[model samples]
Target: MAAKRRRPAGKGAGAIGCAPFFVLIVVALIIQYWWVLLIAVGVVALTVALVRSTSGPARPAKVPPPPRPQPVVAPPRAVPTGEDLTAQLRAHKRISRVRDMQEWDYEWIRLAHPGKSVREVNDIANTHFARGRSIGINWGDPSAP
Candidate 1:
């Protein structure tokens, strides 16, 4: 003959037993005193509300546009005036009594042959200018000033 066996409690049976115990404990706590549980729940709820309000989500920072380019400054002499300065220039030319000269009349020489010193070139230019010659000056290399 086989031995008889007893069945284990099921999921619903455990929950049903727990339900009665939970109700009895709650009733006992309510009968003993109710304010302690109420105050504890209130405090927990207030703490949760405070945390949510204070530090829940943050927004991204706004970035500004790059600085605009500053306006360029012109030389004081180049600034145009409301009046016409051409008449003044013409009057100044008349007073100076300068004669128009051509490129061929002036000597087409560079300080000396190639690779002259800066002092020698300056002296040559000064000499020619003093003689009233229209100098056709050029740098050896186009890239030079």
Candidate 2:
């Protein structure tokens, strides 16, 4: 195989060709105000130094370590079990019984008056049952457990 051609090293014409422009500026420096020449030389030197120092784009900075995780804590209370559930149900039943006992006076007065007929009470219960059934049908659910 033929030998591979080596690429040229260092800056090409684009870098070296600026010499004529620099020479012209130096010549003008001799003719013009000294302060203007000084400023121009300073700016040119700063630019050349910056370009030479940073020839490539900057790389991304390295990331620092993440903060350590904190330890987890749990509540000090115990979870309710089947016995707790049964106790809650017993409490609800006690409350319901108290309410029924208080309402018994009104039920006794109604029974003494005999205002509502058994047929009327049955009709009302049937209507309520029908309404509950319709609601259950519409929702596509089984009867409440």
Winner by TM-score: 1
- lDDT by candidate, in order shown: 0.61, 0.65
Pick the lDDT winner.
2
Error of 1 at 131 (Å): 83
TM of each candidate vs. truth: 0.26, 0.23
RMSD after CA superposition, every candidate: 13.9, 20.4
Candidate 2 per-residue lDDT, tens place, 16-68, comes to: 66888999998887887888878999999999999989859887899999999
lDDT of 1 at 143: 35
lDDT of 1 by residue, 19-114 (tens): 888999989989888888889999999999998789656778888988999999876886545455777777778655433222222224442435
* TM-score (C-alpha, index-matched) for candidate 2: 0.23
In candidate 2, the residue pairs with backbone N, CA or C atoms under 3 Å apart (3 or more residues apart, or in different chains) clash, namely none
